[model samples]
Target: MNRNRRRGKKLSRALVTAAMLGDAGTARRLLRRGASPELPDAHGTTPLYAASVQGAADVVALLLAAGARPDTESGHGDEGTPLCAAACWGHAGTVRLLLAHGADPVLREDHGTGRAPLDWAERGPHPETALLLAAAVSSRPAAAP
Candidate 1:
């Protein structure tokens, strides 16, 4: 493999690790060095998804600002969208950030028996997160049947 490509791959992996660790400074530095926020880790988890799942609001914000898609799906089947991950963990702040970035609260998991972000939030018993997701869902136009 090309040297530059190899470096980029390493940087991408590092970015995902930093995101998972909630190390905003490291994540920012990696991003500045050209790490792709959308690049998936070896496990298929994107930086945004990892950050969201960990409730790393700062890292999540950085990733989103760095061009990470708020609704980007990550992880293996049934792992769901970033919004769902945030909601599942009851990360109200992260959920708010994602919603501000246009995340669809009604989006379901990619695999069988898909569940929406609201379902995840409710399952978490995260009343605040659930409310936010509910409002977002109510405000949006219904999906086409």
Candidate 2:
């Protein structure tokens, strides 16, 4: 593989590991040490995306605070948003964190049946997640007349 591709793979692996471990401090340190938060894994999952899916609120927050793109899509066939992954997996805290960080609830996965985060929440096994998404969507300002 080319040098850039190899480096990208390495960074992706490190970020995914840090996220899965839920070690926000370690993730932040690695990011500061030049690990790309936006690097996508072989499965097209970014570190922030993985952290969100794994319900690592602090890691999600750290990645977001570090300027991770909230709307970045997984390059995988899923093409999902971090918010969608968080919602689908019943990660309420991660969902809330992503929302507070201005994640777009309207973002739709390209490969899936084009489901939004709200749709994922609705289909989740946890009713509370659906309720939270409903409340959040309702509370958002309606477009100006």
Largest TM-score belongs to which candidate? 1
lDDT (CA) per prediction: 0.91, 0.82
Model 1: per-residue lDDT, tens digit, 53-99? 99999999999999999877898784678998999999999999999
Worst 10 residues of 2 by lDDT: 104-113
lDDT of 1: 0.91
Q: Tell me the spans in candidate 2 whose CA falls farther than 4 Å from its real position.
A: 1-5, 111-113
Query: Against the true structure, what is each candidate's TM-score?
Result: 0.93, 0.85
Q: Itemize residue pairs with steric clashes in candidate 1.
A: none
lDDT of 2 by residue, 31-145 (tens): 8877888877777778888898889999998888878888788756654888888889889998888888888777687744588888988787767777777787888888799
Predicted structure 2, TM vs. truth:
0.85
Best by lDDT: 1
Candidate 2 RMSD to the correct structure:
2.5
